[model samples]
Each structure stands twice: as structure tokens, then as C-alpha cells.
Target chain A: MRNIIVTGGSRGLGLGIAERLATDGFQVIAIARSQTEVFDAAAQRVKAAGRGALQFHAADLADIEAIPALVKAIRKEFGALYGLVNNAGLGTGGLLSGMNDAAMAQLLRLNIHSPIALTKYVTRTMMTQKGGRIVNISSIVASNGFNALSVYSATKAALVGFTKSLARELGPLEITVNAVAPGFVDTELTSGLGEAGYDKIVRRSALRRMAEVEDVGSAVAFLFSDGARNITGTVVTVDAGNTA
Target chain B: MTSRMADNTEPSVRSTILDEIHRIAALHNKQLAPLTDALPLMESGLDSLCVAVLVASLDDALELDPFAEDENLAFPVTLGDFIQLYENAAA
Candidate 1:
């Protein structure tokens, strides 16, 4: 079975992707702080698959210093990781003047630094094996540039750049790096915004509705599939045509 | 200590949890406002890092596993909401 590691697979888009991958017969190892919930969800996904298994690990993605150790642990547990989805991230919004250094640092650590480090760590393994797939969860704000999410957008934009560069570097090794930028996915992260907030977002979107978490999950699954072997370094937008 | 002694001290723990929530809120550049017991944490604009920090701090201050389970404890939007979770866990 092909083994994969999905960071932040406890809930939201990560969980959705994990579920889809599990159903597709991949050995899914989900990494999240809430091990119990993540494992439970993974268990359900594996059961739904009927041909795959799931493993859960508890780790804080914001602990950038621990990323190497995390990859090592995955190596020990899974032997070979076939795919990695950098889905763990946080969205903090404030004017540059309003955010303190610590807040900004925290955002960068989780959203940018950790993903970069994890990608590098995983790429080494993938390169040795000469095969793997990597999907980064970016945001529409990466290109659209929202007002309150300047820092968040920049971090994601950096991921897009990293994806393209890494794709070029790793193309010969048969490793593809791509990003999926979801527009207004309905997940716990955005659930805080009530109906009024949803309406506002929908109004701005060409599709007149926000993308479901599953929408992004399907796109991520496609990138990992054999069909996407020739496609790399591309940012696939699943944002309901908001960026159109 | 007897039941009465513990009962008398309950409010102190509650107060401490409230203070910690406010501290965390301030760290996120949010003002400490009157929060209800059921307000969702994200509604107040506390992002994921703040939630992680709050969980870590609660773990240390209360000396209990606040996230003993993986259930999403709705972000505490109000000081009271934060206190209630601590009180429940500490109890």
C-alpha cells in the first residue's frame, strides 16, 4: 500500500483529504495535535475504504524546530512516505501595526516556515526513492490579496513560489510539487463567520457560494493520482471561480 | 481538605482561568470584552495559534490535560466560557 502523511488531519480540509485518500486504498498516517479525534476520524475513513488502514500521530506543526524529528518519526513508522500534504496552517488577520512580533512570528512558523521545512525534509526522502507527490494547501488570498490577511496571504504566496521552484528542482526525481488554493471552504476555521459573513463571501464569489471542504479534497486527491503525473508546479484554484 | 474548603476555592481557579484567557486575547491584539459562557472562541478572532497557546497554558496552569480528548472545544469567545471549561476540567 502507498503510505502518505497528512499534517493537520484532525479536521477541516485535512480530514476531508485524508478520508478521500483512505477510501482510495492508501495507507494514511494523519498528523495532528488532537490524536484521539484524528485517529477516530481516520478509523472511520479506513473502515469506509475497507481496503486501507490509518495511523494517527500527535504533533504541533507550529513547533518548527521539531519538523525534522517529525519526518524521522514518519520514516520509522511508515518506512516510505509516498505523498505529503502540507495542510496544517492558521489564518490570523490584523493590520501590520496591530500585530505584535510574536503573533506575526507564530503565523509565519505555522503557515510558512513549518511547511517549508517539512517539504524539504520530505523531499530528501522522496528524492532518494525517486518518486513522490506533494500538495500544499494555499489560499485565494495568496494571489487575490485580501485586506486584513496581508501576512497570511504573503505566507501562502511564498508556498506557491516554493512549490514552483521545488517542482523544477525535483522534476527529474519524479516528485511533483503543487498547491491547491481553495476559496472560502466551509470548515471549522471559517465557521466563526456567521450567515451574514457567508453571504458576503458568496456575493463576492462568481459561483455565488463558498467551496465545500470536499471540493478542495477532491482537487488534492487528483494531484496525487497517476493522472497528474505530467502536471507539476501548478496552483489549482478550487475557489468557486472567485479568482476568475 | 474538605468539600467546603474545595468549594470555597473554586472561584479562585475560575478567576485565574479568566485572567489567562484575557492575557491570551490581548496577545492576539483583541480587547478583553464581556464574554458569555457559550461564546465561540473563533468568533472573537482568536486564530489557531492562540488556541494552541491557550490549550498549552491551560495545561500548565490547571495542571490537567485540557485537551485530554480530541474534541473541538469551541474557542472560548467569552471569559466566562473560558472559565467554565477550566472549571469543568478541574472539577
Candidate 2:
């Protein structure tokens, strides 16, 4: 039973990823600040089937300084960590010029600093084990620009670079790192856009439909599978050809 | 070595540092000669990535990272200097 940590796994795309991995027989430690009723139900269903285990770990990932101790505690309880899904992030969409400095700082802290700090400690365990998988949840907007998402897009773009360089650095240890770039996933993160906003996005996509949370989940699952053992340092786009 | 020993009485810190270096070297498939206090880390065949893994691994084992403590501290050039950083910080 491999231990996989899925940050922000209480809901949204993170929940989808957690459920998918758990169903695939991976012991998932879902880290989120709070647990949702939906998340609890899903964990129950997954565990009842005896497919895999889902354990929730409440944490405020934005507290970057506490990450090392957090990682240490996770490892102490769960043993060697086999995978990490750096999916916890804040989607702060706003015009850069009007964005408050404090808001920008908070956005950067959660979206950028948290994951990197989390990864730093997690990779130590991976390095010691000589193998692991890392999947970063990036955004399609990282490559394709969007209105009012300048800061959000930049943060996601940073992950792309982080994924590539980290893949290179940890490659010698047989640890593979990759990013999953999803486009217009229908989750709480995008609910703020409302129906008309989604309609516009759906029409723009080649598939004429927004990508599902499960689509991103499956992509992440693939990266962790044996089939993707040789695939690293690249972005696997799950955007229904939105960029095409 | 004197600088490291001066800060702390424990002799095991030196051995722990050596062990981690060798462990990380093996993980990265880098062959290293038996280390001497004056051996240049770069010449020991461990690249920057390997050295990074070593520092991280040491921090995990020893629970402190001297380099991370002070941004202004010069990077250790020799094996002894590297161990001394940990010792001084631990002290």
C-alpha cells in the first residue's frame, strides 16, 4: 500500500483526484483545512468497497513555515510517502493593476510558496526511498492567457517551470515529476464564473464541453501509473483541445 | 575538525554527516573516495543536486540546517567546512 498525499482533497478537483487514486487502490492521505460532508461520504463509499483507504488530514497549507513539521508528522504515521499531488491552491482572479498588494501576497503564498515548501520536505522522503511520483495541478490559463487571471496564470505557470526543473533534479533518484494542465473544469473553483461564463468556455473548446473534474483526476492517476514510469518533466494537458 | 569539536562534545555528528554523504552518493550512483576533512566536495564527484540531497537528508536526520539559517553564510567548500556548519548550528 503506497501512501499518497493529496492536498486540498476535501473538495473540488482535489477530491476528484483523491477519490480516483483511492479507488485505484492507493492509500490516500487527503490534506485540507476542513472536511466536507461530501468528502466524508466519498471516503466512506471508497473504504467500504475495500478498494483503497482514504484518510483526511486537516492542514492549512498556506502556512509555509509549518510544512516541514507537517510532512514529518505525515511520514511518521503513514511511513514512506510514494506520491504527492500538489493541488492545493488559491485561484485569485483579478486585474493585476487593481489587485490589492495583500491579496496578491496571499495568493502567491498559497498558490506558489506552499506547494514548493511542501514538496521540499516530501521529496526528502522520496529521495531516501529512491523513487516517487509528483503531480502538480497547473491551469490551461498558464499557457493561454485569460482576462483578470494574470496573477493566477502566473502562479500556475511557475508550477510548470518548477515541475520541469524538479523532474530533472530528482530524475537520477528515479523520482518522476509532471504537471496536469486542466481547462475550465466544472468545479467550485470555476463556479464563480456562473452558467454563461461556462457556456462561453464550452463553446470555445474543441470538444464543445468543459472538462470534468474526473478528467483532471484521471490524468493525474495516469502519471502515477506504471505506464508513465518513463514520462517526466512535461505537462499533460487535459483541456479537451481548448488550446487547439 | 577542531572548530566542529569545539562547539559540541558529541563525536557522532561527524559520523552522521559522513554517513549521509555516502548514503546520498549511493542513491545518486556517484562513487566517492573515502572522505578526508580537507577533501573538496566538488572533487568528491557529487554534483550540486547530490549535495542538495545531502543537505536535505542531513537536515532530516539532524533536525537543523545551518545554510538555511543564515542566507549570508558562505557555502562550504570542503567536507570539514560542511560538517562544521551543521555542528556550529547544532551547538
Interface DockQ of each model: 0.01, 0.52
Q: Is the docking of candidate 2 incorrect, acceptable, medium or high quality?
A: medium
Worst 10 residues of 1 chain A by lDDT: A121-130
Candidate 1 residue spans exceeding 4 A from truth: A36-39, B1-91
Candidate 1 lDDT (Cα, 0 to 1): 0.78
- Across A1-244, the per-residue lDDT of candidate 1 in tens digits comes to 9988888887778888887887778888888888666558668757875987777888988887788678878888888789999999887887887888998999998998898988877776665456899999999989997767899899999899999998987786688999999988898778867898789889888888889988998998899888999999999999888788
Q: Which residue pairs clash in candidate 1?
A: B41-B75
User: What are the models' TM-scores?
Assistant: 0.70, 0.92
Error of 1 at B83 (Å): 60
Rate residue A95 of model 2 by lDDT: 89
| TM-scores computed on chain B for all candidates | 0.61, 0.84
Cα lDDT tens digits for candidate 2, A1-244: 9999999999999999999999999999999999999899989989888988999988999888789889989988888899999999998888899999999999899989999989988998887667999999999999999999999999999999999999998998899999999998988889899888888898899999888999999999999999999999999999888899
